[model samples]
Target: MKIKNQIKLSILTMPENVPLARVTVAAFASQLEFNLDELEDIKVAVSEAVTNCLVHGYSNDRNRTVNIVCSIYDNTLEIIVEDEGVGITDVSKALQPAFSTDPERMGLGFTFMQSFMDNLEVRSEISKGTRVTMTKRPQQDLAAAASEEN
Candidate 1:
């Protein structure tokens, strides 16, 4: 979506990419004084989304590239990870919590992302690859919000 505030990191779609993404997210989100939980959430969410690319997205091959962009706006942090691999066939199933194409995965990737962040979105095409946008909105708790409203 013509994203501006973002960073693209290209690497082999391997397990190591997870940590790499976590580190990158930490480095960037740290500037915002993100709490420990926030940092962990961002790292884990990014890793899961990217891992999906290496695994399901490139089930047949790993020749393509995975692009992940991180953005911050509206008091929210957004991460967009895109891969040019075999797209998801069933969007509903893939998004369902605890749904994984691979047996090893807990399918908690999306769940964790959704749990840690305020919003999550997934877009995929048959052969156009998948794009996952995870967003975390940092705001006061419901009680605080209610007080402010009053």
Candidate 2:
């Protein structure tokens, strides 16, 4: 589908930026007329994706950068989060529900992203970086809205 609009952002890989990343994406996604619960789900999914970049990719390094790109289509919202830090050695292992390289993490970031969005894709190369792309389709009254628009 053709994109209606897009937003790109680059922020430091600081712990504090996680919320900012998610909130900004959610705000952009609000144009789709999502209800509160749907908006919260998008926010949570974005938070998890950004937190993974901060905690695992950058390893909490404040100097590194996390890039976020949000796009809006007629019926979908697409979000991409990426970091140029240490990449995952095994993408499949990382996607496991309870597998984590760090002892403190629960390793459910991918799970949450997959559950919340209609599509989730992760690409990583060791020593290069990781990129997460997710897509969500809104569930508003599109039939009525389309008729009204016509």
Looking at candidate 2, the ten consecutive residues that score lowest on lDDT are 137-146
137 Cα displacement, candidate 1 (Å): 2.2
> Candidate 1: lDDT of 65?
75
Clash statistics: count for each candidate: 0, 0
lDDT of 2 by residue, 26-97 (tens): 899998878888899999999998888888888787888999999988768999999888998999888999
Put down candidate 1 lDDT per residue, 1-150, tens digits, no spaces. 443356667777777667988799778766554678878888888877888888888873556678877876645578888999989999889879888878887888888878887788989999998998887754444346689899
Using lDDT as the measure, the top candidate is 2
Local distance difference test, per candidate? 0.78, 0.88
Which residue pairs in candidate 1 have backbone atoms (N, alpha carbon, C) closer than 3 angstroms, thus clashing?
Answer: none
Looking at model 1, residue 21 earns an lDDT score of 81
lDDT assessment of candidate 1: 0.78
